[model samples]
Target: MQQQMIDLEGPYRLLYCSSKGDKDGVIQEIEKGVSPNLADYDKRTALHLASCEGCTEVVDLLLEQGADVNSIDRWGRTPLSDARIFGHEEICKILEGRGGTDPVGLDSQSPCYEIDHTEVEMDGATLIGEGAYGEVYLVKWRGTEVAAKTIRSSIASNFRVKATFMKELALWQRLRHPNIVQFLGVLKHSERLIFLTEYLRNGSLYDILKKKGRFDPPTTVAYALDIARGMNYLHEHKPHAIIHRDLTPRNVLQDEAGHLKVTDFGLSKIAQEKGAYGYKMTGGTGSFRYMAPEVYRREAYGKSVDVFSFALIVHEMFQGGPSNKAEPPEEVADRRAYEDSRPSLSSFIYPEDFKT
Candidate 1:
């Protein structure tokens, strides 16, 4: 019986079975008292391989057998991060629902980009930006420069804050595009969680749009196309689609090369995962100014909502700062967005082809 091969062939069998998503092979191994978290040379567990290959059935089996969803491998990567980077949206939801830990690394198929916090030099660190959730700092790591997004030690202890941070980190790990910010890896500094990415010094599109006012049609279209391409990639991502519920100038970044890359997946969602069509999740997300009508109304929304928010962004690209200027005041913007009326551009000057 396969059960008799535990000592002689357990490691190879478990690794091979997990890699192949063979539920039966894994079950027999586990039934013979093999630990689900058993690792090979790299310390990668069965759950880790299942997560990376998006073996939903096998993942379910391993988890049912008490596999450690949050188990960290030798590289400090977790199964949750593995599911994320390969566009395994269903696996991501499963792992998240199972309370996966967030000690992260790049997907198994990609080159490991995780940086050791001990190797980082903090003397030259500079605070480049801040947000409600965390702050972005420029720091040196292993002789290379990187942007470290740090969560305060006090704030990191909050369960809600940690959940949100984990969600963003997971989603960000999956995205890889020239028009999307690249996620290097993550680090834990005592009580704080720090995620690192390639540092782009040009700042965000919000900064440039705020400074330069409205852009000409040609320039606006160029920026709009970059966002569109990135959004399209997310929308058509394999296994499931991703909706950037908050697609605005603020979430879009500009590199030193004058290229636009979409950032901020904190408010993003996975559409059509887990066998649910137009998957309905909690509502009332995204910025009121750029929010879709259905989203503002708390109605069941699909990926099209991103297009609605993207339209507002495209409008802002040509009309200057925000599309909400002509709407009701900030205090009543949500109500106005959902009730008073839909925002619109009275007129637009662009190429004839762009009208379509």
Candidate 2:
């Protein structure tokens, strides 16, 4: 029975070793008569894992052992597609040489060009916004204006950064909602990875709150409803719930039509259904001022974390901005989590219904 079990598990062992870049273990599995093309539950073959990981040696070994280079995973991604998405240039060259093709089709237009034949100067000139690992540029694509989100070239060569970008890109591409910012397509650049989206001229909710201080009750209600609808769509996603871990005004944008749309999903978490509280999540995610108490405490949390953040945003809508501006944002978050600190709702400022 033990021998039977080992034989049954040989394919998984091959996949594991391949993902870990364990060339020798892969060789052992092959010698034990396991096919190099053995796939996982996701239909991801050894070649697919090796390519995505940038494990060139393991990739080569698998190829030599007759692995199918064009094998498509459950997501319709081939080994070459994973390699390209992760910025593994050398591995990409090897895979392309082996006739590997991108089964997962991405928009092929280059959206980083400028009008009037002038070179795009990325030196803070065309820069519109900045994120933790990327910069957003206002660029021209086929005579239309779009926001190009680019990973900084300095770190674009790093595999981990590319992997994270790809993960976010994959998730964003599938989302369809009026309250969510539309993902236009991807642009392949030699220096960095670029993805495009519809550029919102009105800017973010943060900009609006900064300028107006606070909104009237009717306006606040409209804005809050927009955010709630978007959050509802995300949390109700099929297969898994997506928590916008960073649900703050800064990450929400206002469209030309004056409706709010959710953007910047960099810190979002796709919650896998487990128990009541959802999956174990990474702590310290998102801006401190809007972070949920459970997240600040690093405890297991669920979709309600976004609800907590939504409440803070609604508070800001009524109060003009984040409270306790005198102290650092981190201190404020710490107090909220540990001391149960909350912003005061003045009786004069809020309507009796709102106060209740």
The prediction achieving the highest lDDT against the true structure is 2
lDDT (10s digit) by residue, model 1, range 268-298: 7677663334645444455667666666666
Look at candidate 2 and tell me the lDDT of residue 102: 83
Give the TM-score comparing model 1 with the true structure, all chains together. 0.63
lDDT (Cα, tens digit) per residue for candidate 2, span 227-306: 98778878876567788888989888988767789987767778767224755555555788888888888888888888
> Ten-residue segment with the worst summed lDDT in candidate 1?
1-10
Q: Candidate 2 deviates by what RMSD?
A: 15.9
Q: Which stretches of candidate 2 lie over 4 Å from their true place?
A: 1-125, 153-155, 274-283
Candidate 2 weakest lDDT stretch, 10 residues: 108-117
Candidate 2's C-alpha lDDT?
A: 0.76
Cα deviation of 11, candidate 1, in Å: 47
Q: Give the number of the best model, judged by TM-score.
A: 2
